[model samples]
Target: MDEIATDNRQGILTRIRWKAGYMNPALRRIADRVLKAPDEIKAISIKDLALQCEVSESTVTRFVREIEVQSFQHFKILIAEELSQGSSSTPPITDRHVYEDITDQDDTASVLSKVAARYAMTVADTRAGLPAEALEKAVLAIEEADVLGFFAMGASLLCVENALLRFMRVGKRCLFFRDLGIRKFSISTLGPKSLAVGVSNSGRSISTVDSLRQAKAQGTTTLAITSFPDSPIVRHADICLFTPTVTGVIGPAEYHESMVSKIAQLQVIDVLYSLYAVRNFGRAIEGLERTSDVTALTRY
Candidate 1:
């Protein structure tokens, strides 16, 4: 239900930049050209832009809608406004190719710096792109739900497990299953008062998407945490939270679901958990105290 605000040029451009990496090969070609030459794009017609990108004119139209704009003219209008600002205070992300890949020749210091920068950008982009109203709705849904179910596969499960621990520590009833069959079966039991949260970096994982779809069929509120806004997972979610496309930007093809993306997903989980706790402060505090006291006895 959350929609990106398209009133400003920055919003339109930011969405394009964030989603460029994940777009299909044809769209990426178009996106790459647009970002590198926004000034040129403003003056060029859609037919010309398509010819330059070597894609069809329809693909150009699809790219505009993919960025959530109403039409190509609208897209060009926003770009013109951005250029007319005259200050050049804000620069487009695509102006240069800065995302670097780690190589065999890299030193520890180089790896550390590159990775640190990647994480920093992931956090910032995720924060900027995430919809405020969607987040608020997710937090409220978690707080009101009689029970919570977290679903995910592969590295994305890290976010699911983390949420399971954090929310459970605050005395909320939650469930997670590593087994696909168990997950599907458990989802079937959830009713209108329950919430189903699916975490997927690519948002195309069949297990995760189908789980959300199944949950929705059961009348449970569904939420999705993913990097792709237009992904298959969004169709099934009642509320959706999006992370920035980190792996898409820094590509070696193998890093599609890398830890860099996980950092963004985890950040979303941390914010959701924090907000839920604040809303039920007294109960959450008391639950934390009790859990801490019990766990303390296990410590050496």
Candidate 2:
């Protein structure tokens, strides 16, 4: 995955100063105070900040507006970004009393229930947010393409390989590439008559992004199935499909959020396969019969 550029405190302070130049004197003074002591101001309430700056609450509000942030809450994100860049050590806990109040509740049943609930929520959110237009476009692209290339890396590679099998069963010409080198080779060879689909939950996989780029350069229609539309993969894709997945470190454990995203992608492929079958009903029926005949010979 492509690394996301982290914003630092200096960067935020610089932006604030640049924006402050265009603001009225009252609003600019408020911005100057906040930028001068960002850490101190971050800990202060907006009301307290307004009081400290000797400005009306509206003036403080106007200051945030001049900086292009929605509100003080968003402005604090810049401060947090700055603090994060400077802090090598862990953050100090302000809520020590809460930690002391915690009792031993780490039962297996409780853990299982929480995990199941999180997974269920992921699935529900992904299904609810499925884009209808993107889904239809992907289905049509697969159905009409001379060849369909499926590319994924890490856990998503498993999903793409399974989808290749499913597409093959329905008489589609499909190829699945889990190997990075092979993926690049295939993309270079594929032509405009082909379609390339890549799956990545983070949408930052370098290999997946590179493969899509190569495919597009070769005149192939590129599609990206990912959880984030704002990711690098989306930029190179002709069609972008998305699913909902929470972003975080899951420790040394398997990622349940990514699993949910994979399930959502598979559901999309299933829908595409069904549509393709309906559109080419006679051909699909003939293919099924041929497979049944081969099975009959083995059974006897």
Candidate 3:
């Protein structure tokens, strides 16, 4: 917690949940209540919050420090900043999936609206959780690396491969090793001059975990793009960019892969690509011209 993550003026609760797994039960309860009822929490005093959460006043103070804020007042200030951005009460997690809560009785318009709301919130939350300093370092690492290795499995593979093509078209050396057998070998080839970017929506992909582990072992700079900041994949990363998702709907509560999760990860992909392209305008244009010329005649 040496580098405190202050609100880059977007939001801070999601970032608090990012490290929630390590929090004690009392602190975790406080974190949950803050996210569950932001507006109410805003109106309550610290002592009242302690009483409400059934913890002592000092426990309330500990919850604030667990999230890295200097004091309870500072933590509330960050919450106020987020609320000023227009999200009042927390939204319920219903209708996050088409199959789970949806039924034949549901109308078409209702289905469309709920799905749209889910996507909108997922992107908004992910954007809020982004740490500008970490994003800057990730972009600069990719831009300066001798090569960038893309690692992923299942649905996340598409996002990583898309990143490879985007970086390649912009004149960057990018690697895409789709076969699991060769993935670790390829990872071992990288060193201090390379960047290994692993995309894992769950942050528990076997291929992703092993590849990132090898990348770290070889001294390659590693970046993990995931929804779970405290997941195993993060253990091997030099830096991490967190994505937001419908995590509450997963596991024994109910189960399904979320479309919003994939879209959120893609938003991170687009952010990285946009930042790199802006930073290297001339080279990007040159590479685009070279690639477009080869396919230009086919387009008529």
Give per-candidate clash totals.
Answer: 0, 3, 0
lDDT of 2 at 272: 69
**Stretches > 4 Å off in candidate 2:** 1-106, 248-257, 292-300
lDDT of 3 by residue, 1-300 (tens): 323443432246656756554456788788778866776766689989988889999999988776657877778767776666544333344524355345555699978887777677677767756778878989999887999998998888778867877888899998877778888678777889999998887788888988898898888999998766557998999888877563442123113555567887888888999899999999999999999977687786
**What value does the lDDT take at residue 258 in candidate 1?**
67
**lDDT by residue for model 2 (1-300), tens:** 111121231145544543443356788678778656777866778899888888888888877766556668767876776656546432344422212112244466765675576566556555545556667787788877998988888778767777775667667788765567776777776789899998887778888898888889879999888765446887789987665553321111123335555666676666667777888888877777767766578775
Please provide TM-scores, in order, for all candidate models, with all chains considered together.
0.70, 0.60, 0.70
- Model 3 spans > 4 angstroms off: 1-15, 19-105, 249-256, 297-300
Model 1, range 1-54, lDDT digits (tens) per residue? 133243362245546756664468899898878767677888899999999999
**Clashing residue pairs, backbone N/CA/C < 3 A, model 1:** none
Arrange candidates by lDDT, highest first: which order? 1, 3, 2
What lDDT is obtained when candidate 1 is compared to the true structure? 0.78
Candidate 3, after superposition: displacement of residue 37 in Å? Answer: 15
Off by over 4 Å in 1: 1-14, 17-100, 249-255
lDDT: which is higher, 1 or 2? 1
